[model samples]
Target: MTPLLSWLTAVLVGVAPPPPGRTRELSTRDRELLAVCQTDQFRRVDVRIASIVEWRERRGRPYRTIPPDASLPEGHIAFTFDDGPDERATPKIRALLAACGVYGHFFIPGTRVGGPKARWAIAELKGLLAEGHIIGTHSATHPSFTRGVVTSRDRRRELDRGREALEATLDIHPVLFRLPYGEGHWDSEVLFEISRAGLVDLHWNITSDDAKDKAPKEPGFQGLTADEVLARIERSLDFSRRPGERLGHGVLVVHDTNYRIAALLPTLLNRLVTRGYTFVRFVGPLVEGRDAEEDTGVPRRD
Candidate 1:
Protein backbone atom coordinates (compact mmCIF):
# COMPACT_ATOMS: atom_id res chain seq x y z
CA MET A 1 0.00 0.00 0.00
CA THR A 2 1.05 3.59 -0.53
CA PRO A 3 2.19 5.61 2.50
CA LEU A 4 -1.07 7.51 2.58
CA LEU A 5 -3.11 4.36 2.13
CA SER A 6 -1.16 2.58 4.82
CA TRP A 7 -1.54 5.46 7.21
CA LEU A 8 -5.25 5.55 6.46
CA THR A 9 -5.51 1.90 7.18
CA ALA A 10 -3.71 2.39 10.46
CA VAL A 11 -6.03 5.20 11.40
CA LEU A 12 -9.05 3.06 10.58
CA VAL A 13 -7.64 0.21 12.61
CA GLY A 14 -6.87 2.65 15.47
CA VAL A 15 -3.42 1.22 16.01
CA ALA A 16 -0.69 2.70 13.84
CA PRO A 17 2.45 0.99 15.04
CA PRO A 18 4.97 3.64 16.02
CA PRO A 19 8.53 3.50 14.79
CA PRO A 20 11.01 1.33 16.72
CA GLY A 21 12.19 2.88 20.00
CA ARG A 22 9.90 5.85 19.42
CA THR A 23 6.58 4.60 20.72
CA ARG A 24 5.89 7.88 22.48
CA GLU A 25 7.45 10.47 20.23
CA LEU A 26 5.95 10.82 16.78
CA SER A 27 8.50 11.44 14.08
CA THR A 28 8.01 14.08 11.41
CA ARG A 29 7.13 11.44 8.83
CA ASP A 30 4.59 10.01 11.24
CA ARG A 31 2.89 13.36 11.53
CA GLU A 32 2.86 13.74 7.76
CA LEU A 33 1.37 10.30 7.36
CA LEU A 34 -1.25 11.07 9.96
CA ALA A 35 -1.95 14.40 8.31
CA VAL A 36 -2.48 12.61 5.04
CA CYS A 37 -4.60 9.94 6.69
CA GLN A 38 -7.15 12.15 8.39
CA THR A 39 -7.54 15.05 6.02
CA ASP A 40 -10.78 16.11 7.68
CA GLN A 41 -9.23 16.00 11.13
CA PHE A 42 -6.44 18.31 9.93
CA ARG A 43 -8.37 20.42 7.47
CA ARG A 44 -6.70 23.61 8.64
CA VAL A 45 -3.22 22.23 8.01
CA ASP A 46 -3.10 23.13 4.32
CA VAL A 47 -4.54 26.58 4.81
CA ARG A 48 -2.17 27.38 7.62
CA ILE A 49 0.80 26.05 5.66
CA ALA A 50 -0.21 28.10 2.65
CA SER A 51 -0.40 31.23 4.79
CA ILE A 52 3.12 30.57 6.03
CA VAL A 53 4.41 30.11 2.47
CA GLU A 54 2.74 33.28 1.26
CA TRP A 55 4.17 35.18 4.19
CA ARG A 56 7.61 33.84 3.40
CA GLU A 57 7.30 34.57 -0.28
CA ARG A 58 6.39 38.12 0.52
CA ARG A 59 9.22 38.42 3.05
CA GLY A 60 6.76 39.15 5.76
CA ARG A 61 7.97 41.34 8.57
CA PRO A 62 7.95 40.37 12.22
CA TYR A 63 4.57 39.76 13.91
CA ARG A 64 4.75 42.88 16.07
CA THR A 65 4.58 45.49 13.33
CA ILE A 66 1.14 44.45 12.16
CA PRO A 67 -0.69 43.85 15.42
CA PRO A 68 -4.47 43.84 15.07
CA ASP A 69 -6.00 46.88 16.73
CA ALA A 70 -8.15 44.76 19.05
CA SER A 71 -5.12 42.90 20.36
CA LEU A 72 -3.15 46.01 21.24
CA PRO A 73 -3.01 47.23 24.81
CA GLU A 74 -2.05 50.72 25.84
CA GLY A 75 1.71 51.18 25.55
CA HIS A 76 2.25 47.79 23.91
CA ILE A 77 5.51 45.85 23.99
CA ALA A 78 6.00 42.10 23.59
CA PHE A 79 8.39 40.27 25.88
CA THR A 80 9.63 37.01 24.37
CA PHE A 81 12.08 34.53 25.90
CA ASP A 82 13.96 31.72 24.22
CA ASP A 83 16.01 28.61 25.21
CA GLY A 84 14.03 27.76 28.27
CA PRO A 85 11.88 26.09 30.62
CA ASP A 86 15.04 26.32 32.78
CA GLU A 87 14.76 24.31 35.98
CA ARG A 88 16.42 26.75 38.34
CA ALA A 89 15.13 29.93 36.77
CA THR A 90 11.73 29.25 35.21
CA PRO A 91 9.70 29.11 38.40
CA LYS A 92 11.17 32.39 39.58
CA ILE A 93 10.55 33.97 36.20
CA ARG A 94 7.01 32.66 36.17
CA ALA A 95 6.40 34.22 39.57
CA LEU A 96 7.80 37.54 38.41
CA LEU A 97 5.61 37.61 35.33
CA ALA A 98 2.64 36.76 37.48
CA ALA A 99 3.34 39.52 39.97
CA CYS A 100 3.53 42.08 37.20
CA GLY A 101 0.37 40.87 35.48
CA VAL A 102 2.26 40.53 32.22
CA TYR A 103 2.52 37.64 29.84
CA GLY A 104 5.72 36.48 28.14
CA HIS A 105 6.19 34.32 25.09
CA PHE A 106 8.48 31.38 25.87
CA PHE A 107 10.03 29.67 22.84
CA ILE A 108 11.18 26.30 24.08
CA PRO A 109 12.90 23.22 22.68
CA GLY A 110 11.38 19.77 23.05
CA THR A 111 14.48 18.39 24.73
CA ARG A 112 14.05 20.71 27.69
CA VAL A 113 10.83 18.99 28.64
CA GLY A 114 12.99 16.36 30.30
CA GLY A 115 13.21 12.57 30.17
CA PRO A 116 12.62 9.57 32.45
CA LYS A 117 15.02 10.48 35.24
CA ALA A 118 13.83 14.08 35.61
CA ARG A 119 10.50 15.75 34.89
CA TRP A 120 10.62 19.22 36.46
CA ALA A 121 10.67 21.09 33.19
CA ILE A 122 7.37 19.61 32.10
CA ALA A 123 5.78 20.86 35.31
CA GLU A 124 7.26 24.27 34.71
CA LEU A 125 5.92 24.29 31.16
CA LYS A 126 2.49 23.43 32.45
CA GLY A 127 2.78 26.18 35.02
CA LEU A 128 3.68 28.69 32.34
CA LEU A 129 0.65 27.67 30.34
CA ALA A 130 -1.56 27.76 33.41
CA GLU A 131 -0.40 31.28 34.12
CA GLY A 132 -1.61 32.47 30.70
CA HIS A 133 1.80 32.83 29.06
CA ILE A 134 2.05 31.85 25.41
CA ILE A 135 4.38 29.04 24.41
CA GLY A 136 6.04 28.84 20.97
CA THR A 137 8.15 26.09 19.47
CA HIS A 138 11.87 26.84 19.47
CA SER A 139 12.85 23.51 17.81
CA ALA A 140 13.02 19.83 18.59
CA THR A 141 16.59 19.97 19.82
CA HIS A 142 17.45 23.64 19.50
CA PRO A 143 19.52 23.31 16.33
CA SER A 144 20.87 26.35 14.53
CA PHE A 145 18.23 26.99 11.88
CA THR A 146 20.37 29.37 9.81
CA ARG A 147 23.49 27.23 9.37
CA GLY A 148 23.74 26.39 5.68
CA VAL A 149 24.68 22.79 6.41
CA VAL A 150 21.30 21.96 7.96
CA THR A 151 19.11 20.39 5.24
CA SER A 152 15.56 21.49 4.60
CA ARG A 153 14.22 18.07 5.56
CA ASP A 154 15.99 18.20 8.90
CA ARG A 155 14.66 21.67 9.50
CA ARG A 156 11.11 20.56 8.77
CA ARG A 157 11.49 17.67 11.19
CA GLU A 158 12.72 20.04 13.85
CA LEU A 159 9.66 22.24 13.45
CA ASP A 160 7.11 19.47 13.05
CA ARG A 161 8.45 17.16 15.74
CA GLY A 162 8.86 19.97 18.19
CA ARG A 163 5.25 21.02 17.70
CA GLU A 164 4.12 17.43 18.11
CA ALA A 165 6.08 16.98 21.31
CA LEU A 166 4.80 20.22 22.79
CA GLU A 167 1.19 19.54 21.86
CA ALA A 168 1.42 16.09 23.35
CA THR A 169 2.80 17.44 26.59
CA LEU A 170 0.79 20.63 26.98
CA ASP A 171 -2.35 19.44 25.19
CA ILE A 172 -2.31 22.68 23.19
CA HIS A 173 -0.59 23.08 19.86
CA PRO A 174 1.35 26.26 19.20
CA VAL A 175 1.41 28.13 15.90
CA LEU A 176 4.17 30.57 16.79
CA PHE A 177 7.82 29.66 16.20
CA ARG A 178 11.28 31.14 16.40
CA LEU A 179 14.46 29.67 15.03
CA PRO A 180 17.01 28.59 17.57
CA TYR A 181 19.57 31.32 18.27
CA GLY A 182 17.25 33.73 16.46
CA GLU A 183 19.24 33.09 13.30
CA GLY A 184 17.67 33.57 9.90
CA HIS A 185 18.21 35.31 6.57
CA TRP A 186 15.47 36.88 4.50
CA ASP A 187 13.52 34.25 2.55
CA SER A 188 15.89 31.51 3.65
CA GLU A 189 15.00 27.85 3.19
CA VAL A 190 14.74 27.59 6.97
CA LEU A 191 11.99 30.19 6.79
CA PHE A 192 10.19 28.15 4.16
CA GLU A 193 10.45 25.09 6.39
CA ILE A 194 8.95 27.06 9.24
CA SER A 195 6.17 28.22 6.95
CA ARG A 196 5.60 24.63 5.89
CA ALA A 197 4.78 23.78 9.52
CA GLY A 198 1.96 26.32 9.66
CA LEU A 199 3.74 28.65 12.09
CA VAL A 200 4.41 32.35 12.09
CA ASP A 201 7.99 33.48 12.58
CA LEU A 202 8.06 35.73 15.63
CA HIS A 203 11.42 37.49 15.54
CA TRP A 204 12.48 40.17 17.97
CA ASN A 205 13.54 43.68 17.13
CA ILE A 206 15.32 44.18 20.47
CA THR A 207 17.69 41.78 22.20
CA SER A 208 18.76 41.89 25.85
CA ASP A 209 22.27 40.65 24.97
CA ASP A 210 22.16 38.44 28.04
CA ALA A 211 23.98 35.66 26.23
CA LYS A 212 27.21 37.55 26.79
CA ASP A 213 26.91 36.98 30.50
CA LYS A 214 26.13 33.30 30.03
CA ALA A 215 29.27 32.77 27.94
CA PRO A 216 31.93 32.05 30.52
CA LYS A 217 34.82 33.84 28.88
CA GLU A 218 38.30 34.63 30.11
CA PRO A 219 38.85 37.64 32.32
CA GLY A 220 38.28 41.08 30.78
CA PHE A 221 35.78 39.80 28.21
CA GLN A 222 33.56 42.70 29.31
CA GLY A 223 29.97 41.52 29.32
CA LEU A 224 27.07 43.85 29.91
CA THR A 225 25.70 44.04 33.39
CA ALA A 226 21.98 43.64 33.96
CA ASP A 227 21.67 47.43 34.05
CA GLU A 228 23.55 47.77 30.78
CA VAL A 229 21.36 45.13 29.18
CA LEU A 230 18.29 47.02 30.29
CA ALA A 231 19.82 50.18 28.83
CA ARG A 232 20.30 48.47 25.50
CA ILE A 233 16.63 47.45 25.59
CA GLU A 234 15.71 51.04 26.34
CA ARG A 235 17.74 52.24 23.37
CA SER A 236 16.08 49.72 21.10
CA LEU A 237 12.68 50.94 22.22
CA ASP A 238 13.74 54.52 21.54
CA PHE A 239 15.10 53.67 18.12
CA SER A 240 11.78 52.20 17.09
CA ARG A 241 10.00 55.39 18.01
CA ARG A 242 9.65 58.30 15.57
CA PRO A 243 8.48 61.82 16.06
CA GLY A 244 4.70 61.62 16.19
CA GLU A 245 4.96 57.91 15.68
CA ARG A 246 2.01 56.16 17.23
CA LEU A 247 2.72 53.66 19.97
CA GLY A 248 3.34 50.82 17.56
CA HIS A 249 4.29 47.41 18.85
CA GLY A 250 7.76 45.80 18.99
CA VAL A 251 9.07 42.45 20.19
CA LEU A 252 11.90 42.18 22.75
CA VAL A 253 13.95 39.01 22.98
CA VAL A 254 15.42 37.75 26.24
CA HIS A 255 16.69 34.39 27.45
CA ASP A 256 15.78 32.27 30.47
CA THR A 257 18.61 29.79 29.99
CA ASN A 258 20.62 31.47 32.76
CA TYR A 259 19.98 33.32 36.00
CA ARG A 260 21.41 36.68 35.08
CA ILE A 261 18.38 37.85 33.12
CA ALA A 262 15.92 36.08 35.34
CA ALA A 263 17.36 37.78 38.38
CA LEU A 264 17.01 41.14 36.73
CA LEU A 265 13.57 40.57 35.22
CA PRO A 266 11.96 42.66 37.90
CA THR A 267 14.11 45.63 37.00
CA LEU A 268 13.29 45.30 33.31
CA LEU A 269 9.56 44.95 33.93
CA ASN A 270 9.58 47.84 36.34
CA ARG A 271 11.29 50.10 33.85
CA LEU A 272 8.81 49.24 31.14
CA VAL A 273 5.82 49.74 33.43
CA THR A 274 7.18 53.01 34.75
CA ARG A 275 7.68 54.19 31.21
CA GLY A 276 3.98 53.72 30.43
CA TYR A 277 4.44 50.46 28.55
CA THR A 278 1.78 47.83 28.99
CA PHE A 279 2.77 44.24 28.74
CA VAL A 280 0.61 42.49 26.13
CA ARG A 281 0.36 38.88 25.11
CA PHE A 282 1.34 38.04 21.54
CA VAL A 283 -1.67 37.95 19.25
CA GLY A 284 -0.97 35.31 16.64
CA PRO A 285 -2.05 31.83 15.58
CA LEU A 286 -2.77 29.40 18.38
CA VAL A 287 -4.33 25.99 18.93
CA GLU A 288 -7.60 26.59 20.68
CA GLY A 289 -7.79 24.64 23.96
CA ARG A 290 -6.72 21.06 24.53
CA ASP A 291 -7.12 18.27 22.03
CA ALA A 292 -7.49 14.51 22.37
CA GLU A 293 -4.97 12.58 24.41
CA GLU A 294 -1.68 11.80 22.66
CA ASP A 295 0.77 9.20 23.83
CA THR A 296 4.03 11.10 23.44
CA GLY A 297 6.25 8.10 24.29
CA VAL A 298 8.83 10.71 25.23
CA PRO A 299 8.56 10.36 28.98
CA ARG A 300 7.77 13.48 30.92
CA ARG A 301 4.62 13.57 32.96
CA ASP A 302 2.68 16.78 33.38
Candidate 2:
Protein backbone atom coordinates (compact mmCIF):
# COMPACT_ATOMS: atom_id res chain seq x y z
CA MET A 1 0.00 0.00 0.00
CA THR A 2 1.02 3.61 -0.48
CA PRO A 3 2.66 5.08 2.61
CA LEU A 4 -0.27 7.41 3.35
CA LEU A 5 -2.83 4.68 2.84
CA SER A 6 -0.72 2.33 4.91
CA TRP A 7 -0.65 4.82 7.73
CA LEU A 8 -4.41 5.25 7.52
CA THR A 9 -4.97 1.50 7.61
CA ALA A 10 -2.62 1.16 10.53
CA VAL A 11 -4.54 3.78 12.42
CA LEU A 12 -7.89 2.08 11.75
CA VAL A 13 -6.61 -1.36 12.64
CA GLY A 14 -4.94 -0.13 15.84
CA VAL A 15 -1.49 -1.35 14.81
CA ALA A 16 0.28 1.86 13.94
CA PRO A 17 3.42 2.62 15.84
CA PRO A 18 4.22 6.11 17.02
CA PRO A 19 6.09 8.31 14.59
CA PRO A 20 9.88 8.55 14.84
CA GLY A 21 11.37 11.46 16.74
CA ARG A 22 11.21 14.63 14.65
CA THR A 23 10.96 18.36 15.09
CA ARG A 24 7.38 19.67 15.38
CA GLU A 25 6.35 23.07 14.12
CA LEU A 26 3.14 25.04 13.83
CA SER A 27 2.28 27.65 11.21
CA THR A 28 0.40 30.83 12.01
CA ARG A 29 -2.81 29.30 10.66
CA ASP A 30 -2.20 26.10 12.58
CA ARG A 31 -1.67 28.04 15.79
CA GLU A 32 -4.76 30.09 15.12
CA LEU A 33 -6.91 26.99 14.65
CA LEU A 34 -5.46 25.36 17.77
CA ALA A 35 -5.88 28.57 19.74
CA VAL A 36 -9.54 28.81 18.84
CA CYS A 37 -10.05 25.36 20.31
CA GLN A 38 -8.31 26.45 23.53
CA THR A 39 -10.23 29.69 24.11
CA ASP A 40 -12.74 30.03 26.93
CA GLN A 41 -15.31 31.39 24.48
CA PHE A 42 -14.85 28.43 22.19
CA ARG A 43 -15.08 26.00 25.07
CA ARG A 44 -18.28 27.38 26.51
CA VAL A 45 -21.47 25.26 26.33
CA ASP A 46 -23.64 28.23 25.42
CA VAL A 47 -25.59 29.11 22.31
CA ARG A 48 -22.52 30.48 20.52
CA ILE A 49 -20.67 27.16 20.74
CA ALA A 50 -23.08 24.48 21.90
CA SER A 51 -26.75 23.54 21.82
CA ILE A 52 -28.78 24.35 18.70
CA VAL A 53 -31.83 24.72 20.92
CA GLU A 54 -30.15 27.62 22.69
CA TRP A 55 -29.21 29.25 19.37
CA ARG A 56 -32.78 29.07 18.13
CA GLU A 57 -34.21 30.67 21.27
CA ARG A 58 -31.54 33.39 21.45
CA ARG A 59 -31.51 34.31 17.76
CA GLY A 60 -35.33 34.13 17.36
CA ARG A 61 -34.81 33.36 13.69
CA PRO A 62 -37.63 31.79 11.71
CA TYR A 63 -35.42 28.92 10.59
CA ARG A 64 -36.02 25.54 12.25
CA THR A 65 -33.48 23.95 14.56
CA ILE A 66 -33.37 20.47 16.02
CA PRO A 67 -35.51 20.50 19.13
CA PRO A 68 -34.50 18.88 22.35
CA ASP A 69 -36.08 15.41 22.49
CA ALA A 70 -36.88 14.14 25.94
CA SER A 71 -37.64 10.82 24.33
CA LEU A 72 -33.95 10.48 23.71
CA PRO A 73 -32.34 9.24 26.88
CA GLU A 74 -29.31 10.94 28.31
CA GLY A 75 -25.93 10.07 26.77
CA HIS A 76 -27.36 10.15 23.27
CA ILE A 77 -25.19 11.88 20.66
CA ALA A 78 -25.34 12.39 16.91
CA PHE A 79 -22.45 12.52 14.44
CA THR A 80 -22.54 15.07 11.63
CA PHE A 81 -19.90 15.08 8.90
CA ASP A 82 -19.21 18.11 6.73
CA ASP A 83 -17.40 18.72 3.38
CA GLY A 84 -17.90 15.29 1.83
CA PRO A 85 -18.31 12.83 0.12
CA ASP A 86 -14.59 12.50 -0.54
CA GLU A 87 -13.44 9.95 -3.09
CA ARG A 88 -11.34 7.88 -0.70
CA ALA A 89 -12.25 9.00 2.79
CA THR A 90 -16.06 8.87 2.72
CA PRO A 91 -16.40 5.19 1.97
CA LYS A 92 -14.03 4.35 4.79
CA ILE A 93 -16.09 6.42 7.20
CA ARG A 94 -19.35 4.85 6.05
CA ALA A 95 -17.88 1.41 6.60
CA LEU A 96 -16.76 2.33 10.07
CA LEU A 97 -20.16 3.73 11.03
CA ALA A 98 -21.85 0.67 9.61
CA ALA A 99 -19.58 -1.62 11.57
CA CYS A 100 -20.50 0.23 14.72
CA GLY A 101 -24.22 -0.11 13.88
CA VAL A 102 -24.65 3.65 13.77
CA TYR A 103 -25.52 6.25 11.14
CA GLY A 104 -24.21 9.77 10.48
CA HIS A 105 -25.44 12.97 8.84
CA PHE A 106 -23.31 14.02 5.86
CA PHE A 107 -23.28 17.62 4.58
CA ILE A 108 -21.86 17.62 1.06
CA PRO A 109 -21.18 20.38 -1.46
CA GLY A 110 -23.17 20.33 -4.71
CA THR A 111 -20.00 20.69 -6.72
CA ARG A 112 -18.87 17.29 -5.51
CA VAL A 113 -22.11 15.52 -6.44
CA GLY A 114 -22.67 16.49 -10.07
CA GLY A 115 -21.25 15.77 -13.54
CA PRO A 116 -18.70 13.26 -14.80
CA LYS A 117 -15.90 14.18 -12.42
CA ALA A 118 -18.00 13.26 -9.42
CA ARG A 119 -19.39 9.88 -10.47
CA TRP A 120 -17.57 8.17 -7.62
CA ALA A 121 -18.92 10.62 -5.09
CA ILE A 122 -22.42 10.24 -6.46
CA ALA A 123 -22.14 6.50 -5.97
CA GLU A 124 -20.87 7.02 -2.44
CA LEU A 125 -23.83 9.24 -1.54
CA LYS A 126 -26.24 6.66 -2.82
CA GLY A 127 -24.55 4.00 -0.75
CA LEU A 128 -24.72 6.16 2.34
CA LEU A 129 -28.43 6.78 1.90
CA ALA A 130 -29.06 3.10 1.26
CA GLU A 131 -27.25 2.30 4.47
CA GLY A 132 -29.67 4.52 6.47
CA HIS A 133 -27.44 7.60 6.78
CA ILE A 134 -28.77 11.13 6.30
CA ILE A 135 -27.60 13.61 3.63
CA GLY A 136 -27.66 17.41 3.77
CA THR A 137 -26.46 20.17 1.48
CA HIS A 138 -23.36 22.12 2.42
CA SER A 139 -23.56 24.53 -0.59
CA ALA A 140 -22.80 24.70 -4.29
CA THR A 141 -19.22 25.93 -4.15
CA HIS A 142 -18.65 25.62 -0.41
CA PRO A 143 -18.27 29.42 -0.16
CA SER A 144 -18.54 31.38 3.06
CA PHE A 145 -21.86 33.20 3.40
CA THR A 146 -20.45 35.78 5.81
CA ARG A 147 -21.91 39.21 5.12
CA GLY A 148 -20.15 41.14 2.31
CA VAL A 149 -18.40 38.00 1.11
CA VAL A 150 -21.22 37.44 -1.36
CA THR A 151 -24.28 39.40 -2.43
CA SER A 152 -27.71 38.36 -1.17
CA ARG A 153 -28.59 37.11 -4.63
CA ASP A 154 -25.47 34.91 -4.58
CA ARG A 155 -26.34 33.59 -1.15
CA ARG A 156 -29.77 32.47 -2.35
CA ARG A 157 -28.18 30.83 -5.33
CA GLU A 158 -25.70 29.02 -3.09
CA LEU A 159 -28.48 27.53 -1.03
CA ASP A 160 -30.98 26.90 -3.84
CA ARG A 161 -28.47 25.60 -6.34
CA GLY A 162 -27.02 23.09 -3.91
CA ARG A 163 -30.41 21.62 -3.00
CA GLU A 164 -31.42 21.71 -6.66
CA ALA A 165 -28.35 19.81 -7.85
CA LEU A 166 -28.78 17.14 -5.22
CA GLU A 167 -32.46 16.72 -6.04
CA ALA A 168 -31.83 16.57 -9.77
CA THR A 169 -29.09 13.98 -9.41
CA LEU A 170 -30.07 11.90 -6.40
CA ASP A 171 -33.82 12.43 -6.63
CA ILE A 172 -33.63 13.05 -2.90
CA HIS A 173 -34.75 16.27 -1.26
CA PRO A 174 -32.48 17.20 1.63
CA VAL A 175 -34.28 19.28 4.27
CA LEU A 176 -31.15 19.92 6.32
CA PHE A 177 -28.47 22.55 5.58
CA ARG A 178 -25.23 23.62 7.23
CA LEU A 179 -23.18 26.77 6.67
CA PRO A 180 -19.76 26.27 5.26
CA TYR A 181 -17.15 26.81 7.98
CA GLY A 182 -20.18 27.64 10.16
CA GLU A 183 -19.77 31.17 8.80
CA GLY A 184 -22.88 33.31 8.45
CA HIS A 185 -24.51 30.91 10.87
CA TRP A 186 -25.87 33.80 12.89
CA ASP A 187 -26.27 36.17 9.95
CA SER A 188 -29.88 37.28 9.61
CA GLU A 189 -29.96 37.37 5.85
CA VAL A 190 -28.25 34.01 5.63
CA LEU A 191 -30.76 32.47 8.03
CA PHE A 192 -33.63 34.03 6.09
CA GLU A 193 -32.41 32.51 2.86
CA ILE A 194 -32.03 29.13 4.48
CA SER A 195 -35.48 29.33 6.03
CA ARG A 196 -36.90 30.50 2.72
CA ALA A 197 -35.51 27.37 1.13
CA GLY A 198 -37.64 25.20 3.47
CA LEU A 199 -34.58 23.67 5.06
CA VAL A 200 -33.53 23.24 8.67
CA ASP A 201 -30.12 24.57 9.65
CA LEU A 202 -27.96 22.24 11.76
CA HIS A 203 -24.96 23.08 13.91
CA TRP A 204 -22.75 21.09 16.27
CA ASN A 205 -22.00 21.37 19.98
CA ILE A 206 -18.77 19.36 19.73
CA THR A 207 -16.01 19.64 17.13
CA SER A 208 -13.35 17.06 16.25
CA ASP A 209 -10.91 19.72 14.99
CA ASP A 210 -10.14 17.50 12.00
CA ALA A 211 -10.48 20.16 9.30
CA LYS A 212 -7.00 21.73 9.68
CA ASP A 213 -4.96 21.82 6.45
CA LYS A 214 -1.97 19.51 6.62
CA ALA A 215 -0.28 20.46 3.36
CA PRO A 216 3.47 21.01 3.61
CA LYS A 217 3.59 24.12 1.44
CA GLU A 218 3.63 26.46 4.41
CA PRO A 219 6.76 26.89 6.55
CA GLY A 220 5.34 25.35 9.72
CA PHE A 221 1.79 24.13 9.04
CA GLN A 222 2.28 20.60 10.31
CA GLY A 223 -1.42 20.48 11.21
CA LEU A 224 -2.83 18.34 14.03
CA THR A 225 -1.77 14.78 14.54
CA ALA A 226 -4.32 11.98 14.92
CA ASP A 227 -3.72 11.86 18.68
CA GLU A 228 -4.23 15.61 18.91
CA VAL A 229 -7.49 15.37 16.98
CA LEU A 230 -8.82 12.72 19.38
CA ALA A 231 -7.67 14.79 22.35
CA ARG A 232 -9.56 17.85 21.12
CA ILE A 233 -12.73 15.83 20.65
CA GLU A 234 -12.45 14.43 24.18
CA ARG A 235 -12.03 17.94 25.54
CA SER A 236 -15.03 19.24 23.61
CA LEU A 237 -17.20 16.40 24.90
CA ASP A 238 -16.21 17.29 28.45
CA PHE A 239 -16.90 20.97 27.90
CA SER A 240 -20.33 20.24 26.38
CA ARG A 241 -21.73 18.75 29.59
CA ARG A 242 -24.04 20.75 31.80
CA PRO A 243 -23.69 21.01 35.58
CA GLY A 244 -24.47 17.76 37.48
CA GLU A 245 -24.46 15.76 34.23
CA ARG A 246 -22.41 12.64 33.88
CA LEU A 247 -21.93 13.19 30.11
CA GLY A 248 -23.07 15.58 27.41
CA HIS A 249 -25.46 14.92 24.56
CA GLY A 250 -25.60 16.84 21.29
CA VAL A 251 -24.24 16.95 17.74
CA LEU A 252 -20.55 16.35 17.07
CA VAL A 253 -18.88 17.67 13.88
CA VAL A 254 -16.07 16.17 11.84
CA HIS A 255 -15.00 16.32 8.19
CA ASP A 256 -15.02 13.30 5.93
CA THR A 257 -12.79 15.23 3.52
CA ASN A 258 -10.01 14.67 6.01
CA TYR A 259 -9.05 11.01 5.69
CA ARG A 260 -7.34 11.09 9.06
CA ILE A 261 -10.69 11.59 10.75
CA ALA A 262 -11.99 8.49 9.03
CA ALA A 263 -8.88 6.56 10.02
CA LEU A 264 -9.40 7.44 13.65
CA LEU A 265 -13.20 7.02 13.67
CA PRO A 266 -13.05 3.47 15.00
CA THR A 267 -11.12 4.63 18.03
CA LEU A 268 -13.44 7.58 18.57
CA LEU A 269 -16.60 5.52 18.33
CA ASN A 270 -15.21 2.92 20.69
CA ARG A 271 -14.44 5.55 23.29
CA LEU A 272 -17.93 7.07 23.09
CA VAL A 273 -19.65 3.70 23.27
CA THR A 274 -17.51 2.63 26.18
CA ARG A 275 -18.60 5.76 27.99
CA GLY A 276 -22.28 4.64 27.63
CA TYR A 277 -23.19 6.94 24.78
CA THR A 278 -25.86 5.91 22.28
CA PHE A 279 -25.28 6.87 18.65
CA VAL A 280 -28.05 8.75 16.84
CA ARG A 281 -28.81 10.67 13.64
CA PHE A 282 -29.70 14.35 13.57
CA VAL A 283 -33.06 13.66 11.93
CA GLY A 284 -35.41 10.85 10.99
CA PRO A 285 -36.99 8.59 13.61
CA LEU A 286 -34.61 9.64 16.36
CA VAL A 287 -35.68 13.27 16.34
CA GLU A 288 -39.12 12.88 14.78
CA GLY A 289 -40.89 11.84 18.00
CA ARG A 290 -39.86 8.21 17.96
CA ASP A 291 -37.89 6.15 20.43
CA ALA A 292 -34.25 6.18 19.34
CA GLU A 293 -33.59 2.72 20.67
CA GLU A 294 -36.46 1.21 18.68
CA ASP A 295 -35.61 3.07 15.46
CA THR A 296 -31.83 2.71 15.48
CA GLY A 297 -31.58 -0.62 17.32
CA VAL A 298 -28.84 1.01 19.41
CA PRO A 299 -29.81 0.31 22.97
CA ARG A 300 -29.76 3.04 25.55
CA ARG A 301 -27.32 2.66 28.42
CA ASP A 302 -28.46 3.21 32.00
Best by TM-score: 2
lDDT of each: 0.59, 0.65
Tens-place lDDT per residue, model 1, 129-237, is 7776778888888877767327878888888888887877777667778777777634456666675676656777666677775334312112467677778777777
The model with the greatest lDDT is 2
Regions of candidate 1 where Cα sits further than 4 Å from its true position: 1-74, 116-118, 214-223, 246-248, 283-302
What's model 1's lDDT at 150? 79
Residue 78: error of model 1 in Å? 0.7
Clashing pairs in 1: 24-296, 24-297
List pairs with backbone clashes in candidate 2.
27-220
TM value for model 2:
0.71
